[model samples]
Target chain A: MRHSLTLRIGPATFRIGSAWAQPIDQLARLYADYPDVDGAIADFTVRLQPTSAVRRWVRPSIFITGDHGLADAAPMSLAHGLLAAEMGMNLQMALGWRRHLLLHASSVEKDGRVLVMTGESGSGKSTLAAQLGERGWRLMGDEFALLDLDSGAILPFPRLVSLKNKAIDVIAGEVPAARMGPLLGATAKGDIRHMVPRADAVARMGEGGMPALLLFPRFGSGPAERPVGQGEVFMRLTQASTNYVALGEPGFAALTRFVAQVPARAIDFPSGEAAIAMVDRLWSEIA
Target chain B: MSAALLVMALRDPATTAALDATGWNSLIAMARAERLIGTLAFRLEGLGVPDAVRPILADTRDDAAREARQAIWEADRARAALAPIGLPVILLKGTAYAAAGLPAGRGRFIGDLDILVPRDRIDAAADALVAAGWEWVKEDPYDDAYYRQWMHELPPMIHAERDRMIDVHHTVLPLTARPTPDAAAMMADAVLITDGLYMLCAEDRVCHAAAHLLADGDLQGGLRNLWDIHCLCEESSERQDDFYLCLFEKAAHHQLTAAVWRALRLSHHLFDTEVKAYHVPIEVDYKLRWSDRAFISRLLARNGWGQETRKALVFAFFVRSHWLRMPPLMLARHLLTKWRKGHRPQ
Candidate 1:
């Protein structure tokens, strides 16, 4: 038995797979009118095989059918969860390709790019993104920002901000009436994700914003936060990008163009609340 | 002829296993072998060989052997071309392997050509190569910025018309570590081959190899380098005094005596290569640790497992030779670059 799942984030579509036979009707009922749900794209395909001396149970073969191409891999019990998470991450990467080109940092738009927060995964990017979104900042992407290579313009891919354990509680408390979803299973990091609804998804789905300010945000336990220099911000953000080297001359030109245009900064906040307030304040100042 | 050669090559279970593991279809293997043969023929000509005997030397019915020869030829041509640009090219692993008289096309396949140039002329050297129709290989924006801003070498370049690749480097490492040795001075003393191209003298070459081995840590690649050092030292032993004196001069010039001492000790222990008398004290343990058998053995097991290990080991010998010919600071700088890139520090 095999099962396939599809998720659409921005313009990208991801197809996933499962090993055992699953009732399509039940799956449809579960995902019916789900906000994150785009549409089903893959037909489930399974291949049976024999066990070999090097292995115990014969791993079933599963295939995902979609626009990218059919991806076939071993269909074990663990494959479903892994595929789902992979699809989510891949969607994020595709949606935010532009930002990925420039800084390779996570970002969210607010008041037409008046505020853009950038940081690596553990640096509280998701928490900050969620808080800003709650305060009326349009969610851009948690993973990658797809930048038009020629123009260096950022295209928006507003999606759910994945919140982990403590952050999930914090968001729920902050927006008590916010629609909360079930706890998704643990990921590689052992933290569970609860898909919270994006506040501006309905209004801003067709809207895109220009990037103005770049920020590198970090959460600290102690008090006393100060602004880092432009040089240091450039150095740190440049190092964080994925294709910084792969883009070659065009990449460099784009980076220089970006840095020159956007004012970069580093912000340190002791708590998520303080961080949200600071971001709001910064947004107000710039707007 | 092709079928017979394939049959003969497949007689070895190792080749069969490699073919299976890599999922190389027969057509792909044949095409790869043909390309390899073509590249080899091109490279041998660059080495000043007449075009007549090149086909004879490069001809291989066996896909793997032909492919290996082709890689060797590309590497040689890449090194040879560096001469026309006024830069001294120290042909590292591939050309060195071929030069050491290994089976013509049966050695390690080179992915890219590694050549060292003086630090001062790095920009000019890169421009020179670029003028010769070598395009800078595209890298991601972050990597592009990092290489331009921090790295010792520009992104690698590939010839537009040929299958040759070259990594043009200035200093061996990044600037953060403050490694010594004036690249400009070394280039001044470089030995000119045909055209305006030059190569580091035997002494500088040996020092470079030593530095590479020490700073690169226990990378599996070091095995090939060690073998190269052993073979090159043996070949140049008759001029041992001259080589040592040149090495001494470089060590003194660059203030890299510690690096030289460490390289010398490791060469002596691992490859049994002798170092001339120099009154510089060095920690033998630290030097030995670079080429320690336990470390090499582990790396070998991890990278060159199965029957292919023998051929890989043979390639490792020649690869080791390139490390000794570099200055210590250059090697340190190279290691730092790799570290900053999030690659395992060699």
Candidate 2:
């Protein structure tokens, strides 16, 4: 690696190395508010390497790799280097992290309790989490939600909330310009911009909140809510977790305990405002 | 170069206690690259590690345990699938290690299940497996024809429901390879492991691993393959008297004397495996042979970052693999076909 940077994201620190300086520079700008953990050993390392020697000069492809790698990962052009770095970090956590049962969900903390939203890729969880972050809810995380195995608390991951397509202008309207990263246009996922959580979220990232609500949010639907069954929740969560099968017995035990304790629902919304109002009602109704 | 620390950690786990954060990080990366993290997890069990590194190993141990179970379950599925055919099924390599409860199976990560059948029985066994829900993984006609014509195993098959792969072989090495091990003799000596499962005899098992490591492939991921030989030899030699004697005799009968000897010398060199047998010495030579040193460098080509450092030597060994598999004329034709088909080095 010719360039490198180390920064702490909530409880985990990442040491990102790259064959080029542009990606690291972009990451530094996006995560400027995050604490610098220079000289600290990182839990994961992400490398943005060139696909080959020729590729470094011609077409300049980036192969994202680290402690763990997916063999079928296609190389990205130099334009998407930052996205590649983020994916590399996510890949390492998905494959290697074991201190927590990781859930592919977004979460926000309020009054010492947490609300977790999970669904498929286009589920609008990121938009809701980002929107609520400004409306008095401290955004916990927008990507992976780290669940403590023993305590069942949701530890904050606090990565930048990546907004895509229409969600960009929606959240960009609320946050100040300095709080948002540059618009990355025409990515594989189409037009992504990263929004940093408020300063309080970064400052209190170490705090863990008890999981009080679990909702499966679906976007582009009529406003409706229904209770999700225990069996369905268990199966869906196992699928949502990248390391559930790898954790084996402890994973089974932790998930079983979690499903028993937490009440879950599937909520449908036509817009973010409607979703937020329903979420507020749901939160107050629970205990 | 980073392989030094990795080899030390594998050969003697106690020395790893002195490793610092940097040392442990590099060691773990190298082990993962070698696909021996599970083996290292087992080796470092009960040993103290840094605060942060503990969960990594613990998680790896759990993952390896899951892999072992899945491997055995796949083997069981094959057993039940092929029972009606009435042909013997012999487990090979990692699957055999796990089924026979060998030391090599401890924390072994098996990717696919390998089994052997008689040459005449292979077609029936393959058909039976397909009937049992195993589908051909290779869609390329050339690859399929290549496997059926020149390879030891049929084109790899993955179970439709389980998503695991199983390889059916009539013998250990490819038919085009120099040595022609008597597949029937090996099948005859297959000891019954369970109701419908069998593995090669003790001597044949070790020899087959040696031949596979040396003759069958480029010593890519050679560390784990060598570790298998080390654990197998260490266990069998301690428990069974005359184990080395039988190993050597089988090696000669299978025409794998050179491959087996090279395996022993390399394993003893890299891992200090104890091979106390007549006429088989691991004494360091003041003058090392060219081939001997090439094999050593080829095995240690990977750096701590899991990157292959020695490109020239790596390519040489890759060609050396195809060279060992077939004669020059056939090798040229095969290489051309593969190259023209847009097969680039991964």
RMSD of each: 18.4, 2.4
On a 0 to 100 scale, what is the lDDT of residue B33 in model 1? Answer: 34
On a 0 to 1 DockQ scale, where is model 1? 0.01
TM-score for each predicted model, relative to the true structure: 0.42, 0.95
lDDT of 2 at A19: 87
Tell me the spans in candidate 1 whose CA falls farther than 4 Å from its real position: A17-84, A87-102, A174-186, A202-206, B1-346
* CAPRI tier for the interface of model 1: incorrect
Residues A139-226 of candidate 2: C-alpha lDDT, one tens digit per residue: 9998889888888899999988889999999999999999888788998889988888999999999998999889999999979999
TM-score of 1: 0.42
Candidate 2 DockQ, CA atoms: 0.49
The residue ranges of model 2 lying beyond 4 angstroms of the native Cα positions read A10-13, A32-35, B277-288
lDDT of 1 by residue, A16-108 (tens): 333333423323333334345433321111122112222223443323222122224333222334334344335334322222364455567
Instruction: State model 2's lDDT.
Output: 0.87
Task: Pick out the ten consecutive residues of candidate 1 chain A with the lowest summed lDDT.
Answer: A42-51
Candidate 2 residue-wise lDDT at A180 = 89
